[model samples]
Target: MFLGMAVFLVGCAKGGSSLNTVPVKGRVTLDGAPLPGATVTFSPKTPEGRTAAGMTNENGEFVLTTIRAGDGAVPGEYGVAITKPVATAGPVDDPRARGGALTPEQMAQIREQAKTKGGAEGGSAIPKKYTSPTTSGLTATVKRGEKNEFTFDLKSQ
Candidate 1:
């Protein structure tokens, strides 16, 4: 009885946290122009694993990866957020240049600072609403056996 109970508990512990990811890719454009170097994120509407994200290349193309590079995300509906902050100021101190590796939290803070006070003397090319999943009005459904390609055409005005 004791061994059976132990096995049951172990099975329960390993039951639900498996990652079943699907490939997701997309393009982002603003005012008909490619928005390069933008950060695109997919936050699962229900409780999934960690969020998946990708950075757009120069052609404004991105591929989503959650656990491993290019490994993709779990199948689900996601709320999307995109942010691209173009710097308007001159050279500023970067933590990386000082040989200190910045944590994700620190990197996020830097991005926020740039959005609020960096671009063109504190201006942003992309609308602020697109920076948050709650406000971006972007959604995508990643299906199990479907090509999850999406396009987001944004307006600066």
Candidate 2:
């Protein structure tokens, strides 16, 4: 599970400046089981907020970031979308299949895919409706002062 977040922090987010982001973390579950490797996106309901995203670990836990790694998101209402693409054979496959330490070969493959597969397109294990914020039927409100933790329980049918 830690591996998934580590990869995302290294591959997706780069650090430099800061924003008025709060601490937002959450878990994603599909049909009562952890939905790992899924990308959890918080699409801003207003122009005042920016989009924030995080990748779920094997336990489906995630910490959101907007401007930098783990920086969280601006306080506002957001429509949520969760998507996990079908895996192609590689070291960077599904989190369930990827366990234990990473070999140098695995690291190499990860770096390459981090560059090439940034978009991460394919069919999803979950229903297609969960892939889009408009149709996800999920929404969250990130408050300003406290820890913003959420759990999304999605159904297959």
Candidate 3:
């Protein structure tokens, strides 16, 4: 009888929570290739909207789970942004150095710019557009209890 009661209590506890989650998954790419480490954000477009974001993994894939509370990115539209990473530094003797192409003046300018703030000032990189593109021009719908998939083909605006 004690075993039966224990089983009943466990089952009851499990049944109390609601399964209101809808899985959001997708792949990010640029120029027809996977873009790993791209930061993907899904922002709601309504008053009830809440922001949810995830970064692409090594395989350029991302998944947003347990998206409960605050409407699931609305069942209609959203704004998506993909921020790609930039590379820096290289070997002094590297062949790609342009055969000591950057003259002292140019090198000094580069260093001076790198020390500035907000983008070039702080050695920080900026997207070609100087800002992330808005996916308002794109649409991603969310369905209840089902996974909504999308493939974001990012391009420079």
Candidate 4:
């Protein structure tokens, strides 16, 4: 009886099975700078392929777990679509005057930096796509059980 129970536990573990799923992890950077909080939508190469997707973290890093459906990204080509970053609004000072610092010039400088970084109202610093050159080096083909690294370089259109 004990032997049978042990065998059942081992079967449950399912070790050494190729079906054991691993994750695809990497960071998204632009001009050698981290693009934190960027939305990375990865659609499978085909309806028969495994569908997995995730969003980048504050470090512009993301991990997509393989679904049990079709083979994870068939060992072939793939298309990557990285949406333009949406800038986040900085913390606004309360009108209640809880702050005890920050001169008028300093505040102005802060606003200016934010605007230069993205926009006064916070917008994408890069265009949605390279309207001219299609070779933007934005796509990548992930290998099975392998972690792929992808870097994107952007310039003003």
Count of backbone clashes, every candidate in sequence: 0, 0, 3, 0
How far is each candidate from the true structure, as Cα RMSD in Å? 6.9, 10.2, 15.0, 14.5
For every model shown, what is its TM-score relative to the native structure? 0.69, 0.70, 0.52, 0.47
Off by over 4 Å in 4: 1-21, 66-76, 85-125, 130-137
Task: Name the TM-score of candidate 3.
Answer: 0.52
How would you encode candidate 3's per-residue C-alpha lDDT over 41-74 as one tens digit per residue? 5655565543444456677786642232222233
Query: What would the per-residue lDDT of candidate 1 be over residues 112-156, giving only the tens digit for each residue?
Result: 543342233455569888876777888888899998999999888
lDDT of 3 at 132: 31
Candidate 3 regions off by >4 Å? 1-19, 65-76, 87-136
Q: What is the per-residue lDDT of model 4 for residues 54-99, given as tens digits with 9 covering 90 to 100?
A: 4455677765434322213333344554544454765444211221
lDDT of 4 at 124: 58
Q: Is candidate 1 or candidate 4 better by lDDT?
A: 1
lDDT of 3: 0.48
- Judged by whole-model lDDT over C-alpha atoms, candidate 1 comes out at 0.71
Let me know the TM-score candidate 4 reaches against the reference structure: 0.47
Off by over 4 Å in 2: 1-18, 91-121
> What shift in Å separates residue 46 of candidate 4 from its native position after superposition?
2.8
